[model samples]
Target: MATCCFLSSSILRHPSHTTPLQGRLQTRRNFSFFKITAIFWGPKKTTTPTTRSMMDVSLGTFTLIGSPEQKPPVEPKELQQVSISVVSSISNVSSIDWDACAVDANGQGIFNPFLSHAFLSCLEESGCAVQETGWLPQHIIAQDENKNTIGVVPLYLKSHSYGEYVFDHSWADAYYRFGYQYYPKLQSCVPFTPVTGQRILVRDAWYKDQVIDMLISALKDLALKLQVSSLHVTFPTETECQRMKKDGFLQRTGMQYHWKNRNYKNFDDFLMDIKQSKRKNIRQERKKISAQNLTMKRLRGYEIKDKHWDSFYRFYRNTTDSKWGQRYLTRDFFHNMGSKMGDNVLLIVAEEDDKLIAGALNLIGGDTLFGRLWGCLPQAYYPSLHFEACYYQAIEAAIELNLSKVEAGAQGEHKVQRGYMPVATYSCHYIVDEQFRNIISDFLVHETKQMEVVMKMMQDSGPFKDGLE
Candidate 1:
């Protein structure tokens, strides 16, 4: 599960591995779901899957953590003799095959760089998201009869729910109060990243739908077999959320602010579409960068050198080390991603007297510019640097690149006024026990309605001109 929504001083940064509400979890007699103290982290235990039963499906017999109560519906005959296994490392799969699945799974043209082989592999290789960090990779890989790698999921046997943007601390606390184990649960997400994309990845094929169904079954069965309290597929596409809900998973909804691009020639042309007040405020914020004598530069791929990576890592750590912050990504991750992801990496840095003072890290998606991380020299505070580096630069980059939107990472009401209005985000959960499942499901029902109200309010209060979407 993701941490809480409380945005700290270092606003406009990546969303995961945050200082959750657990630190100050409030309590009162006979409290509700939001009251319980979060048991965020604990002793790291093994989540290695053991063969408990063999599931008989058209694809083939596959190992499972728990046996199904009923047989799965018929799989398409085209997916004959399919094999699914939980691998411990991303290195076990070739980037060529893994990336192919990640790219193809996006029925839309959007590509999530966080789901790419390079990104996940760098997390493991850099020693940031390993078992010691409570993010043990148990990625699933599926193969068809032809031995073609067709599907993959970036799953983790997590001991804590720190970095996931979907908060389930209350559920864990409930499990604790009821004398149940909750840690070592299965979490499907991009580590230290909250940008939503496809979690159940399948290559484009005639049996794509069947493969997706099978993968869903595999995840549920794996959760049961592992004997974890639940399985969480966080930040999936809304369509995937619906599909999972139809298959017995509990649906959930939350909101994040994202700036959508309307057809515009430039940043000024786009600003005219927003309300005059918000537009004036945005222009003033941009002006602060100049008043501070800071030059903002957007560097992509090879344009970002080792020196920039060095400084950017410091910037990222500065952001994470702020109040209630925890550094999730290691310094090496920056260098590794720089070498591996090439042009997909967007590093916007603030320079003063030719010295790098601050930076914001973003990934260029197929149709979006993702604002992931940001920071500056911790000792000095520049007015509006965070907003300029993370928000304005991202919006400018998205427009310049002709991308569809700019996802300014997690929660921030401030972003709405700056053009990143609320957009609904989704996740699905599967509880092994029916009773507990219903309890959480009931809570989700109420929570989803609240989200709908909040999203509508944000939409109605958007900075855009009345005629804009």
Candidate 2:
């Protein structure tokens, strides 16, 4: 019989010790499924080989509270009623409700329908994200009583972590030392995106925990059943981390810099927020570019035509060719994005002597704007052209659009001095091998603590008069 269970809190009066395998669940709403497996964490023994195979894919409930300034604690809880079903493809799910979970509180962030059926369909249709590309989409969606989506996680059964920003090369090396395989790991993340948003999209705070617990459990079980190396959830919220921690997932911390709008009224207000030295240097950079008879223009939505993509792709090709062995996005992909995503896209191009010298492409979200790709012609000698095309133009547009933040992409201490604040990102891990898991867990504890300390120190060293205050 298919059953549904409702849990309001974490007051676990009856939990199993050892490993929880198959358990009976009480439900309010009737849900249909081909198979049913539930695990509640407590102090009872219920471990079996078959049970282990199924239970490995389940997770219990937990919580994460507070902000970067103050660390909070998580109270332990058990999952009430969870239904786990595996689909053969992402096409089975609707992208509309699945993507709705990504809508931020602000109305100005990018609502990329890429995770949608049409987009994922395009990837599968275009052969962009497939076995050949090492990206196998294995999306997971959880629904409640009315069959409305409660949560959806865009997952990939990745053979390599090339596009993922979170580096696990060190962990892989350590595993190899002990004679283990780390390839063919399960990844729950947005493909080729390091921008911070809801990786696991759920409704309210209560349903959020429930849906997250469900995903964690399913991934673990899939790892064991498929005999894969590990399960990774990248760039999740700190609140998501608390639930993951309670479910026994290893946590890792990463850093990315984002510029926030501080009632900046305009561009000059933003420049004044940075340190004086940085402010002067930026002014000089802007001035130098202005002196070169270069004109910069921002084209959004339908304003960008097919010919624009041709020039932009050429610039993109030049940028990638300059790198020793950099991977390049196909020309078709860029054209497709601009075509499919209108108004949501922005192209900042620099023109000099009636020729396109540099360009940067950004995906504009509701409250946030993301800098994704950039390129420049070698002959264009506009000073600080890269910064202007990528950063300055983005800041100006974000302000003009009244966006709350502009994420400048990854890795830069330099970005800190440029008025971008440091923010900590998170990833959750589950290693199959016990020995390796323990070693990694120890590493995480130390790593997380160090990250906390560094975040505070960076806050203290922030340039703005009222920055950390």
Candidate 3:
């Protein structure tokens, strides 16, 4: 509800040798919805004191900073660019280039198991993400002068926002009251996935910004031509959000828990790092599983056999059926992803007397591990099995892989006592209805403020040792 702008007193000079666009003048933009800071780049460097500082710039329908006329210089090779279009299917994209672009940005083609071609292909092939199931693929691609593929975005036209983790149901209900349709909004993200990674895939890292800008421009243009409500990019990194903010996108925030290692040599070392009471509690839980004669095996990629996946699927079903009374994925989905992704997928299974009792599945990213799903058969050790299969095994595997952090699934305060620290996650929304946009924007302002306060509070309660030596 409140907005403020401050101008930079000085500006940095750029050298002429480098591309003028890189040196182009930048203007800072601050928004009232939340304290969002954005810097816009122009084609050439300028030193005007007014242009140097981040100031609020507003775009039509959406608000952002800087002149909309500012454009990056077009490359000569792309001058005769071929027309690219958005398709509602990933089956149309060239896999080699798609994987190449994905790897170029994130260092691996697919970070989240749910985003992998195998996983998506299974969803599409299995009719899980089809029109019948409410998930319709809306693939966005960019091409060069020769019509050769240059970039791609794995998108889906979602009917319901379930499995997104980024909640916006209230916004949908408000829109419904005003006779507006919220379903089928353009979404550039992995289906049924909350893990964050590159949503825009660029062939070359050098043209990263260019590729992203082009994607945004293309999506906006497509949204207009197709008469879609808006484009939603969820679970994007801070960098991607900043870029979108510059291009005039709304920002929303939420919190999730993740575990991080500080040179923990083993699980005991990690326990020692937590509060003494928590340490004892966790050890006791592990002892309970041990006393039930249950042991867990950590399997990676190809090591996960069909039988293992089958048992894991059973475990997954048990948990979902008991809790939600339904399951999201089928057994075939697990087999397909395991066969395609190999070692990137991890499965930890608990066995009693050589019989599998529980299992959990996780997806590994460049620096993060994500706990996707877990379940256990009706065993004597189901209580502690959830923690061992879902959290503890994940932490152990993260240490083994030397990953930076482990993101436990959504909305679990219990994870905090188990070494998972609370961190804020983000999602942005743009409502097409004029009145609704204003209403939701106002709501988001309050929500973001509350989330920020909660994040700060959680940080204060972090289990980490306080202080400087």
Candidate 4:
């Protein structure tokens, strides 16, 4: 039976063994309006505690009291009536409802294509993210009083962490050395994607905070019930990372290269903002593409034909095979995305003698262009072809579309010289074992410091002109 739970006058509780809170929640109601007063710490722990409040008339009998910095009160075992059911696939949930929580998570009209139903469904429908591939979808769905879907977390019960860009192989090896099994872990992330966005997908309602709190609690409870070694929410937004930290999830920081647009009129306008040497080098590299009789084409929406997807998949497989990387996505995934997402899908193809030799795949967001995959013909090599198709083309497309930035995937310092700057990406982890948690936490502290220093160095070495930083 489906349960319809309400957050009416109920206390939001963290897991029993989670962190402690040093603040209180107060809710006041006047006729139709409900006012919530939340007194908690800010994102930085060293900052002074503060009180923040808001009033919303639409919320009925629910108010949230905790912020990302404050620990939510642990719900008593008796009040754990909120039911969470894990679906084997994302297709079980209707696209309309899932997208409602995804795109409008904050009511600020922010849209992330990576978290949409169409994208996730494509992974499953195409057999890319399934049990056979080690990414068995166990998505957590939460409903409200009226049986309305308020929150949905894209979770996977994984036997390995091949597709997740956040490396956890060391942790697995540690467990194995100690005679502990760590294969079946819970992961909350987009399969093979490392883009930073909201992991805890919740509707943008007045009771959004309460729903998020419930969702976090549910995730921990589910993790324990399944007896997995840990629960991981990777590539979450920085704000989401902080919120999960309050729920006993250890925060992890990573860095990705992103190109931010500054309202350039054209590609030439952008090149002028970078250093002279970088500008000259980029021009030279781009020249290589044309010099080799290669033609670049940007296809979007219906402009991307069936043959385009077929060629792109071959290119994709070629790149993965050559690098000895796992081919996590299937050919059907591209067709599904193109058919469903339409204009949001951007395919940059490099043609030689009218034959598609290479391609770069990207998804358009509300304000950002996400560069996800790139590959070329295994039989041939074109000097600077990868850079042109992936980085340069993405920047040009973002500028033309008036998008804010382009996230060119993960772990590429090479992108730094091509005008992509380093930006911090976040993730949160909940380890079941106390000993492992402590060890990972200490390691994270050092890793974070190192990452900060490296990011600074990358910023200094960025291609931007002097004073741009």
Candidate 4 backbone collisions, by pair: 13-73, 13-74, 13-75, 14-73, 14-74
In candidate 1 the C-alpha lDDT for residue 53 amounts to 23
Candidate lDDT scores, in order, read: 0.78, 0.65, 0.66, 0.78
Model 3, position 446, has a per-residue lDDT of 57
Winner by TM-score: 1
Give the candidates in order of TM-score, highest first: 1, 4, 3, 2
- lDDT per residue, candidate 3, 54-79, as tens digits? 11111112112222233664545434
List of clashing residue pairs for candidate 1? 2-164, 2-165, 2-166, 17-163, 65-225, 66-225
Query: In candidate 4, how many Å is residue 163 off?
Result: 0.2
Q: Write the per-residue lDDT of candidate 4 for residues 17-99, one digit (tens) a residue.
A: 22221111111121121212212121221111111111111112233444444455444441223345567778888999999
Q: What is the C-alpha RMSD of each candidate to the true structure, in Å?
A: 8.1, 15.0, 13.8, 15.3
Off by over 4 Å in 2: 1-83, 104-126, 143-149, 203-208, 378-381, 449-461, 466-469
- Residues forming the 10-long window of minimal summed lDDT in candidate 2: 3-12
Worst 10 residues of 3 by lDDT: 50-59
